[model samples]
Target: MSRAQIEPGGCLILAGTPIGDFRDASPALRETLAEADIIAAEDTRVLRTLLQRLGVTTSARSVSYFEGNEASRTTGLMEEMLAGARVVVVTDAGMPSVSDPGYRLVAAAIEGGIRVTSVPGPSAVLTALTISGLPVNRFCFEGFLPRKAGERRRRLGALTAETRTMVFFEAPHRLADFLTDAAEIFGVDRRCAVCREITKPNEEVVRGGLGDLVSWATDHARGEITVVVQGAPARVVDIDGALARVRELVADGVRFSAAVAQVATATGMRRKDLYEQALAKREEHEDG
Candidate 1:
């Protein structure tokens, strides 16, 4: 195709590749691959395999664009587009920029006055969410948790009050630790679904409470794993009632710290705030 056939200022095409099943490749994806002047891929080897599987031959020059090199490679790709090349960006799976390398290129392209478009295709997030048996009306996607145990716990602790269902991508090896921390922070009884190898022949989804899932992951959690956890049950926060509960626990010989933890978990209040309030109430009673 000639320059006139491409967009006036050239175009940046973000194309979604199949998450697992190769048959899920769209015709638009094939066309974009075959006709583009340059193709930026997360993994060029994966892209070549995809092209071979789809029986599509492309004359387009392929370049590696991934997390490590994205910063340096984006400018060159943008320049190519500025020179009137139809540039297509694809990741190993799913949509580019969702949790992939295309975001930087898209931002740079826009800044450089190039037109950007997407050819939507399979998404592991949406696919897993729809079949997770959790409430889909409202949800949040947490791509991956921090590798460190302390950091992961802090992250999950911050979301303890989130009422919308949560989706998270996790590695197979860390699945047990992830679930264990999630159970401790979110509650052992919270419902969740562990969707593994989505859309592939051996796809499996294990549904249960966080505690049960933790036990199951000990031996069987393998492959690409997506965890969908049901949100915290909605509870009306009543400061007065929570303070009263704290006082009762304290009177029954519970330590101040222990009392605060119990009340916070029961009332969905921040433990630190509850502890301060309980301390103040104790001081007032002593003064009286």
Candidate 2:
């Protein structure tokens, strides 16, 4: 165990584990592994493996806390927190609640008056953004796209005009379908990078438009997928162009709100700004 210690209380600590390559793991995380009064890990086996690799011994108890068991586990963890235990939550990678399983627990802890804190570390979202070849200055992390084909298409369609660099996590099996759908919805030539197995031996980032990516993926690809879609081109300040894009998504059965968001994102304009402008345009169109 490390010398530094965690105070026992109903405090929730969210630790970010390395996405890949254990050597990238931070020393502070190693200390947390030793000091936490209880570790609520996404996978007990994975957490144990990380601890073994770091050569850290723990006096704290370990418990499995993942999507399937989160609801049930929340109660138990909350109880420990209420008992003044320093409960630390971690997923396999990145932050606890982003796309991982710890969100519910964190929400519960907050509602129960438990103090929550985070140990910032490597995040696939940040890593992908850094290497995405897209503007990182203004961006949004969308986490994961919807899994179903219809839902996913509708979702991507709404983002076609989003101007900020958009980051997403996807499964390897659905890579081809997702890319193909993205190409159709966002345009085949829309720039994107499918970052795979980052920071690992087989890590690769395939940069191209959605069309080219679909072609590359057709040959078969593997590893975790993080797709970064380039924001809409800057020429969209032309209200005509923005309206055209919005109408396209709306025609595709996307909701008006989503359509507005995508258009604003693609045009690098504020949502409220676009909405007011869009409403005026809609009224003009109706009058004409």
Candidate 3:
């Protein structure tokens, strides 16, 4: 497609760079980097380092599109893609636009009818989460928390009841403070993990209660820090509440047996157990 008059606009490729080990990068990511018409990097210097590590040379014009200049640069990059140029975005590490620059450019590319795709590779959030020995079935990646202590606490406080595994990126210097505050709010006994320098030489994962991690982070926290916190424990289903619900359903003109079955299914209790309990409670009430 000619740059001057293309039928369809060029594509925006979000290239995922290895968070630590360069070898984790896919062949597609390297080729896309080498062949792109333009590459927008969160840190041009870091991109150059990665190019060296991957032993790949690229002539694509590299431009800085980080938080500070992202707003100004998105338009130019979008214009380039509009002209049938294959533009790729890479962050210092991991995928672009996750706690990094690239979202604005991607949004603009989509708005201008440019095709958007990705060369998926490594992700620190997933790396830390999996290695942290935390639950993987359900998780929520909470990118860097608020820098201010107050805001950070408020944000964490709001997630006190979260039941899914929680992951967060924190600066090495702030890891200790974050752990300490989390221990206080999430409770000292809350199980957690601190994954430091993930997938890199000297990588370390420390798992323990929040109380224990606070002390560990003070001395051992270094490199890129991703904390995988155990989510607030599942709230115990109140047996009495289930029984009361069954009564309410029966009082609403539903038959007692059906009410017991519905409440049992909803509350994860056996129908026989709930039915027996409800009958016993009714008998006790009548006798009283």
Candidate 4:
């Protein structure tokens, strides 16, 4: 939480553009864009279109500051700020700094003693998370997993035990693959939601188990996609009870490893603990 300076040479404004429907644009966002001395846009053309749609005309200087030249352009923006120029940064859509460009410029502005503030508006992440109907008390934003299958699965595997609702940004083309991998690693029954096209007329939020979402995404749903996945359920802490459950399952003909795994998933117990305890219990019974 960086605070803005009451009196500074200049200010850097991070403007949040509408994710989909231009109508979602806020009055403050339009005002900030209109009053800017210099506007650094991720895509100048997109900014131009947005200005026309919002019906807000500005004489401010518009410069491209997308990912390609983010590093190279930050220096120039910083110079303008130090020279008592008010610069506003706008991404193609949504907030400037979240999973988008502006972080470098914001950090530089703060470091250079320039004021930093935000014109918050529509956010795909927040919108999706809200409609997800999942637990919002605790959540994490994991924007974009690895594009490659192996790497994506590895990433999902690490998050298998995450207890917070997880939000992710993914390309439409990779939605199915991501859901499939998420299902495999997080389990087929794990709850999740896929939000598409955000605020636009075609906006859709498909909510279900990871397995169901995987099937839905196979249709290659278009437009920007945000995924909200329910975290792993709370784990049961009774090792002895968990081992007893495992033993019962095994005695009923479930394989030892499978029984342990099943009990671990059901009770949030560790498979290793259940396995070792079950074995020790068996050995102790034999000794008696």
Using lDDT, give the best candidate's number: 1
Q: What is the TM-score of each candidate against the true structure?
A: 0.85, 0.83, 0.79, 0.81
Residue-level error in angstroms, candidate 3, position 73: 0.4
Tell me how far the alpha carbon of residue 7 in candidate 2 is from the true structure, in angstroms, after superposition.
4.3
lDDT of 2 by residue, 1-288 (tens): 332244445688889888888888788888877888899998999998989987889998999999899998899989988998888888887789889988898889889988888787888998998998988999988878888899998778777667789998988888899989988877899889999999989899989889998878867578888989888765537777888878788889978888888878667678998888777877888899
**Best-first order by lDDT:** 1, 4, 3, 2
lDDT (Cα, tens digit) per residue for candidate 3, span 1-288: 222122345888889999888889887877888888788898889989999989889889999989999988988888788778888899998889999998888788778878888888788898888888888999998999999999998788668768789999999999999999999988998889888888899988888999988877888888998899998776666889988988897889979987787666555577888899999987898899
**Which residue pairs come into collision in candidate 2?**
161-266, 162-265, 162-266, 163-265, 163-266
TM accuracy, model 4: 0.81
lDDT of 4 by residue, 267-286 (tens): 66667877788889888988
Candidate with more favorable, higher lDDT: 3 or 4: 4
Clashes of each: 0, 5, 0, 0
Compare candidates 3 and 4 on TM-score and give the better one.
Answer: 4
**Among all windows of ten consecutive residues in candidate 3, which has the lowest summed lDDT?**
1-10
Off by over 4 Å in 2: 1-8, 235-288
lDDT of 2 at 248: 86
TM-score of 3: 0.79
